[model samples]
Target: MSRKKRIAIIGTAGIPARYGGFETLAEQLVRQLGDKYAITVYCPGPKYTKEERKTSFQSARLKYLPLQANGLQSIPYDSLSILHALFSADVLLVLGVAGAWLLPFVKLFTRKKIIVSIDGIEWKRAKWNRLAKCYLWWAEKMAVKYSHADISDNESIQDYTAVRYTSLSHIIEYGADHTVQVTPTAKDKEEYPFLHKPYAFKVCRIEPENNIHLVLEAFATMPGYTLVMIGNWKNSEYGSSLYLQYSGYNNIILMDPVYDQRKLDVIRGNAYLYVHGHSAGGTNPSLVEAMYLGLPVLAFDVSYNRTTTEGKACYFKTAADIAAIIGNTRLAVLRENGFRMKEIAHRRYTWEVVARKYDELVQRVLNNKGKIPVTPSVATIPAEQLISYELAHLQAPTPFYEKR
Candidate 1:
């Protein structure tokens, strides 16, 4: 009889997917791949009590660590998970760069395969302090350089790793099929009075990088539209200040975090438009979820957002930009954009497709003795060959092209 390959999924809040993107992805991976592999997931002890902790969740073993899965504690938390996996797991599917400092020892000492997904450029988020950012920056490099195989959730992130580490990163985005477009029931309407009105909606971490203040300012200035935004307003002083500042506006609704999936979906799916203010991260789960819900997105102007929407959605860089867009854009045009966004999501962001990609990559890495071939950098390509492929408009001899 053949034995199943043991896979350890590390660096998530844990399995029932109560938290964010990593948790959801981890849960979906187990559901999709558990039949073929012997899987175990590590959960944060702080989030789940002793009674809540289970031996297994959805056919995968659950191991709890007595520390937080995020913040400064994550460094040691992930290190412990990696050390434990070293004994029994054949493959360590690490989800972030928090434990990257230990990967060198794991690679040098063991035959275990390390597959990492850096989960966007964590060091660049404005929420992190200078010291935290510096550690994350070093960790990000180590994660890529030491992994057997690496993944980037967006092409923009892939380009970054390609340029910085000169490594080939597999692109695998988050799935949105789990987000259902729901209709509000009478009880739901009673609880959320805004459901009866036409309104714009947003849900994200209330961080400076997400441009939450800018979104709030836009809606506050434009009284013609009602905006409902849900987030962890009490998490930081910045969030609390913004919530207090914007809470007074009759047209603006500052909501607390909503964890129930159906409740969130019902509010999100019924929006007239979805406002995505995130300026960092690759393939944001909220933006894609909004797309899957057939909501027109008005996103912050960033390369990552453009790549996710394929340059099809409305964009804004400032409060005035957002206000102008909302005030001027016609409803029919917005709905048309929503249709295009949904079509793109349905074709690419399903969990089945994402799982298949991960399965193929895992199998290929195992077959090759847990090593992925390094791809050549674009700088090595001949200049004349690059010039030959230029478009007609860009073919004209200029200072930029003269080197060729």
Candidate 2:
């Protein structure tokens, strides 16, 4: 048989399976594409060890470098990974835009197929400073432009890329198959006291984009339902104050990050309703996982979310919307919505399909197939046309509820 596609995966904190989206994406790629691709994954190693270490993972190669996989060091670490991967891998399937500064060099020298997924709109995030944002924006442009093929995880993202870069992008979202219906163990309850309770589930970075405060405020009023949100709550004054404000409330549990899969999935999968208040990011991995497990979704009613949920799941834009959703949307209706979300997940967001897409793209790019087998001159939807779909359904302020 012809040689299997030698593939390199970069831009994750390496994986023996943790919970982050990049890691989960890598894991799925390995799971579904292992037999078809000779894979190499770059991992973080100790800088001071100053020594040799075994390189490889189960059925795939591992190359460990002496730098953190995220933050500033990610630049050189992923850059180095790509440099090394050029040798053994037929395709470079980079995940993020962190190491994109070096992408030009790779393009200059190698015939290796380049496929990149610009993970959300990284430059628009609040975490980056002005210079960082500028660097990231350029990096994002380079990643999309230089790559033999590019991926966008959400339709909104695709729209952004197509509008900005004037290039068609592959829309490949995060798969939720990594999540299992795990039961909380005895040790889980010891670790997390809230594991025993009936609670709503939320896991995300505590940032303005996620709308954490909105979720907290809405949940604070509801006494019957318990809310358990996980994030780096101590990282900011906003997070700290919200935690302090809601800590005394017996119904709300503001927990820190839970890295263990079995421990976290139990609470996540068994949640009464998965409260997804994320106002940013493309098809969020956590939200999709909740959908995959058939948890009732009440997401922020943005195009990104409405598109992710296929415009079928319930949504909320504000505190009142959230309150009305929880109060008015009956349990049976919630269950039906949960089923609807799950049906969408199983039909559209499966690892098998994702892996197949990646595999096909890698092959197509490797053969230099210029582009996918779609007509180049199709009628593209305008921005206003895209937004009009949701605007038509947007609920307006009720005049009957006016204070006058």
Candidate 3:
């Protein structure tokens, strides 16, 4: 590119990140590549707070709008950001699939390049009802079709998009550098009683896709094994129900959401076993962070999880499977697996490396080098058959998708 690409990054929650993957990615991008790219980040404005009156934040051009992030408001918030960004910026690197409806209009009106990441198979999340799933599916399709370059954060996501859209996706995942091993302070020992115990650790949003119920169930039954799980238990009925169900168990410990990195890292880094029970999406933030910290992984037996562990860590599909591993898997075996997990993290999942990949993709998108393959002839299948197959595929059917 001739000069620093003026980039307008949309679809993330906000900067000075204390939330999830997209926010962390934004924060890291500004630190690593801000000098090379002029960035404008869209933030959700205070519709309800005393501090909501404050507009901009930090070094980047912060554009705040009156919309709550991460829900139904995500559509309008991202739509507003994309529409506003079309006025300036050389490239629009939209980080999620929320505002894909405006993508065609952006292309028709301007020569600005667009890059989108349909963040993990979002529609498959169990929190969404059937109607929301349909919208997310459409948005995912549009994001792939309209963007100058589409990113798949994991190899499984890359494979899924390639098979469905016949478009090769650029793979760039969230990095796991935030968690680190910490020698416990005297104050830390005073607060957390479980710091001395041989405990299993997990932290995630309380959702069905995350399989919090399963993890809790397995830990509840086990007598000697101590399990500590962290999440927002007040967010939903499901979370509240799970909390009520498992709160009395002797072996299980449930903590509310904690954003303090030093405290959270101490908890995560000191665990004997890291239990990950996520059933949907690509590479998960918590799972990868545990891997980075050299914790032995006992992940759910999903293809995405399997791929992330590189076929080394132990996998479980049921409560019985989790229990069996917990009872039988030795510390020596786990340490060896943990060593391999750490090696994998070092090789491919660092922020500096992820930042470099994003920068390269941004340059490619701006240069018009990320091209889609030629569309193929439509398959000679009946409409009824197509609908039936699509329905089955959405649930559980044969390999409905092929690598295109």
Candidate 4:
């Protein structure tokens, strides 16, 4: 038999999936594709201690870089990883667009295939400064333009890319089957007394773009109900301020990040409702995980969230909206919503499904010559003829004109 093709994964905090969506994606990809490919994952050195670090995970090799995997340091971290990967890897599976500025060089100088997942519309996020946003915006363009294959996590994002880049982006969302339902033990009850009562649960980075403040404001007024929110509160000034303001509420429980999967599942799976406040990003792992656990969802009113839930879950656009929905909705209706979410998750959000999609993309990119565009045959027709034929709607730059 011939040798296995080498795959290098870049743009994650490291494995054992201690962080957010991309880390978990990396771990699952390794488990799913390790047998078929010689995979090497680049991790952040500063995030792991000597004891936690390992040379390999499962069948994939692990390489550590000195720079952090996110924020300002991510630029160099991803740049260096791509440079190192060029030596021997046949393909570069990039998870984000932070280092996409170098992708043009890679495409121009090297023959290695690039399969990049543009992890949401990063430049549109509120956390980045003007310069950072500009850089990210340009980087996103480069990532889509230069890669052999590009992926979007939601249909809304795919539509956005089809309009902006005129490229047919593959839609591959994150898997949530790794999240399990757990029963709270007697000891767990002692540790978390809130487990005995009904509460709305939410876990996300304490970012402004996530609409955390709006969620807190809504819950603060609902003194009769409890909100158990988990996040890294001390990591940022916005989070710290929210913690200070909301921690004093009798009905709100603001807790730190719980890395123990069982403990988190126990708290999350037991909640009566899951409140997803994210106003940005596509197909969030936390939201999907909650759905997989059969929890009812009240997500923010946004196109991305709507696409993820398939317009089946309740939505809130403001603090008043959240308060009114929770205060008025019947328990039976909420339970039914939870069932709908679970059905969707089971059908679309499993590791096996996601892995197979990635495998197909990998095989295609390995043999493909150039990226495909979703531009329609109608686009090639004369504009004057389209107007004369009453087909002017097709002239609009959107995915609606894509071939059926």
Indicate whether candidate 3 or candidate 4 has the larger lDDT: 4
Q: For candidate 3, lDDT tens digit of each residue in 1-404?
A: 47677888898878878788898888888878888888888888753355654444444777788897778989999998998998878899898888998898887778999999888998887778999899999999988898899988888887788678878788787788867789788788789988887899999989888888888888878989999999999999999999999989888999999989989999989999999998887988888899999999999998889888888999998998999999998899999999999999887889999999999988888777856552322233545676776743333222323434
> What are the root-mean-square deviations of the candidates from the true structure over C-alphas?
4.0, 7.5, 6.8, 2.8
Clashes of each: 0, 1, 0, 0
Q: Which lDDT tens digits does candidate 2 get at residues 233-345?
A: 89988788888998888888888998877667887988878989887788898888899999989899887899899998888888878888888878899899989999999
TM-score of structure candidate 1: 0.92
For TM-score, the strongest prediction is 4
Q: What would you estimate as the lDDT of candidate 4?
A: 0.93
Clashing pairs in 1: none
Best by lDDT: 4
Error of 2 at 162 (Å): 0.9
lDDT of 4 by residue, 1-404 (tens): 49998999999999989878999999999999889999999999999999989999999999999989998999999999999999969999998998899999999999999999999999998888999999999999999999999999999889889889988899999899999889999999999999999999999999998899999999999999999999999999999999999999999999999999999999999999999999889999999999999999999999899999999999999999999999999999999999999999999999889999998998899887577768767778888999999988888655553435
The lowest-lDDT stretch of 10 consecutive residues in candidate 2 is 394-403
lDDT of each: 0.90, 0.82, 0.85, 0.93
Where does candidate 4 stray beyond 4 Å? Answer: 378-398, 401-404
Model 3, stretches more than 4 Å misplaced?
1-3, 47-58, 372-404
Candidate 1 lDDT over residue span 1-404, tens digit each: 38999899999999899979999999999999999889999999989878998989888999999999999899999999999999979889999999999999998988888999999999988778999999999999899989889999988887788767766788899899999989999999999999999999999988889999999999989887999999999999999999889999999999999999999999999999999998889999999999998899999999899989999999999999999999999999999999999999998999999999989878877776444334533444666766777633343324211224
